[model samples]
Target: MPQQVQGVIARSKGAPVELVTVNVPDAGPGEAVVRILACGVCHTDLHYREGGIGDDYPYLLGHEAAGIVEQVGDDVRDLAPGDYVILNWRAVCGTCRACRRGRPWYCFNTFNATQKMTLEDGTELSPALGIGAFMDKTLVAAGQCTKVDERARPAAAGLLGCGVMAGLGAAINTGNVGRGDSVAVIGCGGVGSAAIAGARLAGASKIIAVDVDERKLAVARELGATDAINAREGDPVAQIQALTGGFGADVVIDAVGRPETWLQAFYGRDLAGTVVLVGVPTPEMTLELPLLDVFGRGGSLKSSWYGDCLPDRDFPMLIDLYLQGRLPLDAFVTEEIGIGDIEAAFDKMHAGDVLRSVVILDGPDSDSGSTNPLEAHEGEQVSA
Candidate 1:
């Protein structure tokens, strides 16, 4: 049966999101209904509110989410109701050229639900990243739901759906950071910090974190960065080179996505070193660089889309790692709030005051950002 659930929606460009009843249709072919447990408040959602992603008005926001399958429509396979799942925006079509070539990560024909989730009046809504998970329930393609360990904390596990996954994939997949590699990540936000953690997990001997904020730097160290550079105080490239014994890092990640940061990352790597760009740039952003520098660099420059991650392959493995305490996924979640706190979470994210503000709809979540991993980074509160 079609049902109504409370959800957050941005009705117009630059308007505050409204908590209203949303119409979620019964799962159609190849789709499933997810009862959301936790969803992370991310900058991309803020971009939707600010009309940055598209002119798609009345956007259904929230994508970094964990939930349980409540219903599965026809043609769904290998997934059943009551599965603990993390929702991914990309649900690759198996017959796409990319998928047929065994590189589904570059799937050009990713998909979403065929039916629209709408307003009470039947106004169709465009979902952010093809996922509208800020509600009690959301409908998604069955392929979008990656089942993970049920024992995982929903607040912590949900982070894997987007930013965290991107960061880790930047290092592990795109960067190919390996044992004894000296890596430097520019930007110490959620994504960058996850890169640092990924570098460490990949056995990077020296992981340097570069950022303007001191608090973020502190958290970076806790997440396995061996050195921290205050980008505001000195040339980050120079600092990264200095820490890498004047040779430059083996891998440099531009998590900030700006021309300046990209340039710094280019120069911050050693000869033939890899440069992975995980940051997303605005459409108006442009870069003018020397052609000789590109030719002389003699290395790979890669852009990671969703960290080149295939959710099914990565999500469950990551959750297992988290459960084993090998990954500090909990560190990324600064606090847990209800659906009403989405707007404020955006404010805190913009201010660089928090790594993540998770919206917990059910199950236990942190009342305070007091996890063992967040001890050093915990100080100010984003809200009362």
Candidate 2:
């Protein structure tokens, strides 16, 4: 039987998201039905809503999520019901060329549930980034679920599903940040701040945060930034160089993903430094840099795909680190919101006031609430 659940959906480009009855089907072969506990509001979701990602209308728009597996396909053996896991976009297919080369992180072919989740009118909805999770329950390929420590709170644990993972992976995995390395992260949004935290975790001696918003820069400091560069005050490139003893950072990450920011990241690093682009850009946007400068830079220019993370390896390890207090995962959860409050959360995100406005799917108190628990929960703050 198809399960009817309330979900957030963007029915048309630039239109406000609507809460609709989503008909999630039972797990087919290689798929799993998840009872989502929490999911974070991400910019990617907004992009999807605005038709930036594609013309795929009625996008079910949430991805960074954590949940308990309620059912599994007959062919799925690794996961079982009652298992707590984080949902990831990259469900790498082992047979893909990238995976065959032992770089599953670069797997060209990812997995999504074969069967579609539908609206009440029977219109099939396109899942955002292949995981539609901003609801009571969602169906996904079993490979999209990565089991992690149940001890981790859903609000914090679910973040490993997207933006946080991308940022951390940009620094540690893609940038290869190391001990005593000087790192600079441009744009202190959730992703950029996570990169700062990752650089700190990797023992970066000088973690410089560059952003126009002072509030975000403050958050970056709390995360691990040693210095904050207000891009509005002066030239960010010069500022980054000044902060790094006039030579530039060892690794400069562009979390903003715009051509201008990418150029800043390019020139803000040492001659042989690495520049990691983790920010997602629109299709029409183009980047133009000097071919001479590109050749003279003498370093690697890389783009991080989902932080270049292999979910099986990265998810569990990150959750454990979060549990140990080494990584400040909780800091990312600026507020816990109800599913109804998703639209308002998008406003908060645009205002740059909150790092993440996560939808708490589980009831306020796990032991309390009516038979339909999602109805009883209210948005609440998690103290920073």
Give the clashing pairs for model 2.
Answer: none
Which residue runs does candidate 1 get wrong by more than 4 Å?
363-384
lDDT by residue (59-140, candidate 1, tens digit) is 9999999999999997888899999999998898989999999999999999999999999999999988988999999999
> lDDT, candidate 1, residue 154?
90
What's model 2's lDDT at 46?
Answer: 89
Candidate 1 Cα lDDT to native:
0.90
Q: What tens digits encode model 2's per-residue C-alpha lDDT throughout 2-110?
A: 8999999999999999999999999999999999999999998988998888898989989999999999999999999999999999999999898899999999989
